[model samples]
Target chain A: MRQSRLVQASLFVFLAAMLTGCGSHVPLEDLTISLILGVDLDEKNNLVISESSPVFNQDAKQNIESYQLKAETVRDSRKYFDALATGEVTAAKIQVLLIGKRVLEHEDWFPVLDTVYRNPTFSLNTRVVVVDGPVSDVMFYVPPDKPQMPLHLKEVIDKNIDRTRAVISTLQVLHRQMYESGMTPSLSVIKKEKDVEFTGVVLLDKKGKYVDTIDAQNSAFLLILRDEKKQELTLTIPMTSLGEGGGIFHKNQISFDVSRVKTDVKTSYNKGKFDFKYQIAMTVNVAERLFPAGRVNQKELEKMIEKELKNRLEDMVKKFQANKIDPIGLGIHARAYQYEQYKKVKPHWDEAFAESNIDVSVDVRIKSMGAVN
Target chain B: MKMAKPTLTLPQYIFLIHGVQMGVGVLTLPRETAEAAGTDGWIGIVLSWVLATAASLIIIQVMKNYPKGTILDLLRHYFGKWIGIAGTILFSLYFGIMATVIFIREALFIQAWILPRTEVYILIALLSIPSYLIVRKNITILGRYSVLVFFMTVWMMIFFIIPLKQAQWLHLLPLLKEGWQPILDSVGTALFSFGGFEIAFFLYPFLQKKEKASMGIVIANTLTLFIYLIITIGAFVFFSPDEITIYNEPSIVMLKILEFRFIERLEIVFFAFYLFVISVTVLPLMYMTVYCTSQLAGEENHRRHLIWLLIIAFVYVVLVPPTFDQNKLLQRLIEQAGMVLAFAFPLCIWAYLLILRNIKRRGN
Candidate 1:
């Protein structure tokens, strides 16, 4: 037994020495982990793919390196990126994917993203950003005095999403929306200016074609209607109906932070159409009252805000019906309660939603008026 | 041959059965259930749990007639030596194939997710070490290892709650939208997941509290049902009803949505730790095959048989690493075999026992 222990110890040491291994591991610094990938159509309407990677070697002149090549597909472009980089380009760590608006204008463009989903190594949390201009512009946009563009773009979207200024669109969410017939997909939209700007969100039709865009202001109402409000939802409304004093400074607007919102979609079929009534109860802390406190009483101010918010919401729903895009996923509620009617129209849910009756009612609860009255 | 005393407590019996039932089925259970029944497959899971629990109670009832002997002894006494040998060969074949399928599937997952470049035979060899080391021990240590492994890995369920933040509860709505046909069909698939409950047949004789064994299997089946329900519902809510059917392993793929400030690929770590829980399923079934074979051979020792079994299993996996279509066919075959052995065989023996009693009473 003692001699067997000697043999066991030696065998253990030998096996650990040889086989306690990485199959074929690459050191982190040696591999090119592309942080951002972009796809666009050039002037000739050819598919152009690009990627940006952070350079780790100190000898490189710049902190980031990028490549742009016209390629037919995302998988086809990898070889080009591999050929250009010092190390093999790996996409498992991609943070942001930017699609040019030219690409979104075409139907069946979702296949461009098939590579990410088909490959298990690619992350599902990578943010899918829609570039309002050219993908190349945003891919090349490097502002001075900022961190890497990928990190900057990710933080900008995360910060904006927290404030309810933009929608959150990861690749996983996009896959669900693209396949879900009950509702069309929407993604966060960004534009290339002096710096990268998160403009708002773009709405896609069932076939994954761009229909229309929602600006930052409309996006807030859209999110509230969709029941996707984030931590801080501040809306600046012009109180024209209340006839507040147009002072020399012209402070005729009220800005309030929506602390809580409750939206219930009561669905029923009426007149051969689906009818949805949205009962919205918004709790807000009066952050800025542009009108003088003495001018209006608290109850009257609450009534004014409620009336204004109701009109805005109704108008937003009207736009949704006109565009025939149910980004708010009201069809989800319809299917939940009114299944029989919803299934028949499921193939063309947005059109059925367009013909439906949507009623918007707002019940405003004032949580607090800032430190003053 | 030296044997330890019959010393498995009620909790140990429950964990052993529960842990073994949770095998590689979880990796693809949601998609399998969804393939047949859509999101309403949760109902099928509950139905299978019922069937599995009934079958488990029947096993306990059969064993209660002969307290000191295992199922092998009961078989030989009731039907004589020839039938006893036949039953042994059948049980061994069933358990052996189930363990082999589980072994290959575990290796497939490790190769696909964690180490793609490593040859599968090497991974199979690496996995075999745990089975050999643990199965070589007595039943008491098996029970202890299960209870220990359960506590060590149960906290991993908390990671699932993060994805619930984006969960769309409506995906589960319109339940039974297509009617009852699909839900009933997927019960076969769910029964395969509930297959390893028959390990209780071997464990019944060792249980310290014999009466508590019935309640233990009931609780074990309930725990398995609870796990299946949470994982299925999580997958259902995370993916759209239509989208859930697209991925082969939505349960594992669903983990890709988890991200943190410090970690990006959290599923890699989750899969690494999950190997412990998966082993609780593989090891006990491996030990049961060896034990059942020895009981037939009239040997009190099974450790030597275990070594040969592992060697055969490793060679089989290395020789026939199944492709995608081949894997599906293999799983279907095993599902049918398990349904017969775990569900159908129990009631048959119980009825046989009743008939034997009736005949003896008439003669008297």
Candidate 2:
């Protein structure tokens, strides 16, 4: 019995040792936590990094926040942050990366982005945004009313890009677009206007350098062309009557409130010529009817709207050709359909894209008007 | 004291076979097959299963004819004592290599995913102690424990299948675009995935219902094949063929993408689930190794001798490759050893048995 007790004691001790060795933890005080970071380029063409986190009081309520630090590089920023913050700054918990306009415009942002991608702690799924003004200004924007302002910013950006009618791009998408052949990426562009600001999208070239800004209207068109998830976008079309008694022609703007939009792109190549067709099917709510009110001729109005939409869509396709930006990934379609042709013309795809013949067709089916007529 | 008699049913045998056959190498099977066959890896797996079934049948038939004898006893009966001892040593060495390879692979996975800072020696010690304790149990107890763990492992696969909605079915399309050469190459690599079916030779004598052993082997191979198909198709669909080739552990990486409302990293949950499966697999291999060792040594107190043998084996495994790359080289050597034991040895035994039967008929 005594020997059995000794054996049990030894087993218990062994178990304790094993458990202790396996279980390793980091204390909260020892961790350098970074909530958000904003990156931009200074006048010297060096990287400017700014990081921020909320300050908590003894009772666990957030108090006055700390000042943002500007460093020459991300590594220096971490060193500066480690001295200021209580613990070492861990990149694993970084929620968002905000890039300033100057940084986006800089010729070499790949090195900075590559560092983030290579870090084990930093996730490729983290949200990336381009700030129009100084990144520090955007970082320090804390509305007095909202305590969780950073989370609020994330929610607003995510809702605008994902659920609402705005273009959305993540780090993974950006990396794939920049690295993979036959594709270019676009990021949501944020412009700060003292109190009220507009957020749209900026297109990035294959090398990940900022190319040009897409206006809100063009951004909407680009979003539609890309077939990204969107809700309630307004499309204005100039109407022309094909037959007599077609809308009286005075109120020329036919407004379409797009409820549902689906687009299919087909590519066919024949004898060194690429034929591209974009088929758009959409459900629209007729916001206005300017024709005589006696009997609202549904077929005439539908024809007018369809004709106007086809014209506008053709113009949009022409604009995409002029800019040589295939937001719809037409090049991807071409490569998939005609591999041999694509290979022969692969080097001059951009020049070929500018000269490619793209045909646009719209088939709109009006589901219902509002409660009116 | 004599151990309690085991009442082995077909389902228990099926569970044991499934548990043993599915191990660390399976996670890399698709990529390995793809490397060998290009796009026809799935075909290789199907053909390998066919070969495995035939091999399993030969083993069952041989053991069923001698219901009270194991492979060791049968070897002694057919070949002389010296040859029997050598054959037993070869099998023990094969099992030892397999156990060592599995331990290293599990260590690398744990280090890469779960605990990057943890020492490799500590991980080996932790896994080996529990496995040694489990291996000390009788075969009946081991079988029963395997059944319990088998169900637990199956349920964990539900987490792996959650990413199926995002999978591209087109990646698996354009079938046979590369022709039959790749398919044959894939079959050679995938034959290793079906390695543990030969455990039937060791397990057949312990079964209470001897006739059911063949059915049990078929059922186990079928279940393992089904699981392999699900994970292979799932990985292929979720990742492009190029991406699948790049990932070291595609199944684990696929699991990493899945996020629940509560849990952020489902890979951790999978790692925990796989821990149970690994233990279940390691116990049988360790038991078989010790059993073969005792038989070769001609020891009466086999159980006591088994404890020391396991310790020595564990120490030997821990001392081999110091880094993950070197460990992979060791694993390749072990797989080559597995090919000889699993395929070549069984084919030789079956041919010998058939020739002996023919000679007896002529003499009669």
Among all candidates shown, the one with the greatest DockQ:
1
The local distance difference test score of each candidate is 0.87, 0.71
Off by over 4 Å in 1: A1-23, A243-250, B362-364
Best by lDDT: 1
lDDT: worst 10-residue window of model 1 chain A: A14-23
For residues A44-91, could you state the per-residue lDDT of candidate 2 as single tens digits? 767777776655448645542434556766766777777777656777
True contacts kept of 1: 0.71
Query: Largest TM-score belongs to which candidate?
Result: 1
TM-score of each: 0.96, 0.85
Interface RMSD (Å) of candidate 1: 1.8
Q: Which consecutive 10 residues in model 2 chain B have the weakest lDDT in total?
A: B165-174
Candidate DockQ scores, in order: 0.69, 0.26
Q: Write the residue-wise lDDT of candidate 1 on B119-157 in tens digits.
A: 677787778777788989888889999999989988888
lDDT, candidate 2, at A265: 74
Clashing residue pairs, backbone N/CA/C < 3 A, model 2: A32-A88, A32-A89
